[model samples]
Target: MTRKKNSGDFLKECMADALFILLRTKSIEEITVSEITALANVSRITYYRNFTSKEKVIEFKLDKLISQWIHEHPRKESASAYESSLSFFQFFYSIHDIVQTLIRANLSVMLLNRLILKFHDFNTPDRNEYYRQIFISFGLCGIILTWMDNGMKESPEQMAETVSRRFFPQPEP
Candidate 1:
């Protein structure tokens, strides 16, 4: 027999969908927990149990998307930072709607900061690896935030190439 579905995940998805639906009609500041729970058909207690705040609902979704993308499109072990970064931007661009909403809610920076923590590899003995992750997160996040803010006129490939050149330039021989 198949295992039962995890009701917790289902509730979270309901809440997330409710939140996103509200966001389309109202800014994050205008939304309240009451509205989310009411729309999601879940109690306020369930919301609090799964998410600390409304912002968390969005962060949870974004974190999952990013992790899934990274996992599915594994970077080559020998790939340079530029290649890795381009791959990331490509995937991020594919989900521009979510990122756009996060920016509109003014929670993009906070999400990125928290996600940097989530993705940190504590098992590594190398301190530089930790620092490298932080550096990459901030740098890449800065570029993407700017692009999103400035109307995102450039195509994903263009944005990736431009950012890669500025931030992850080729090393001189």
Candidate 2:
């Protein structure tokens, strides 16, 4: 199916595009609701109704984008565990823009913090889980940045294979 230039998705793309445009020229703190609304051609009423702050836009969009990416390219449940695990890199290819936006806003840390909170098993993060999330978050961010920095020269399939070979070596047989 094709995405069109009307309806809810269109409006979201417009708002996100506007935000990205504004983001390129100014820090999120310096950018205003009015500026985003004006650039988006979306009314202030709508913007305020959907977003409470500029950071909220990044939070909302990045979360939605990553979730959508994962849903669209989900790991095949029946695949071998190793193949399913490699499916993770497929997600990075799909979220380039949103990831870059988070980095540009200096909000990748916030995104990592949010992910840790979301994945916690209980009210409090156990020391083990906390450190696990911290390690994974930093490691994943490094992978994403390095991939981008290298201009995404490797295809997602290549990245997945490289990651599996480099990080998930098979047990000696």
TM-score of each: 0.79, 0.73
Tens-digit lDDT track for model 2 on 69-163? 55766646567534744565666666676666667777667666555444334434588766775676666657766786567888877876776
Residues 1-173, candidate 1, lDDT per residue (tens digit)?
A: 12334678778889998998788779888999999999999999999989998878987777777678768887687987667767877776787777777787776786677557665665677888877877887877887878877878887778777877887788789
Stretches > 4 Å off in candidate 2: 1-13, 74-86, 114-130
Question: Candidate 1, which segments miss by more than 4 Å at Cα?
Answer: 1-5, 122-132
Candidate 1 has a TM-score of 0.79
The candidate that wins on TM-score is: 1
- Cα displacement (Å) at residue 60, model 1: 1.9
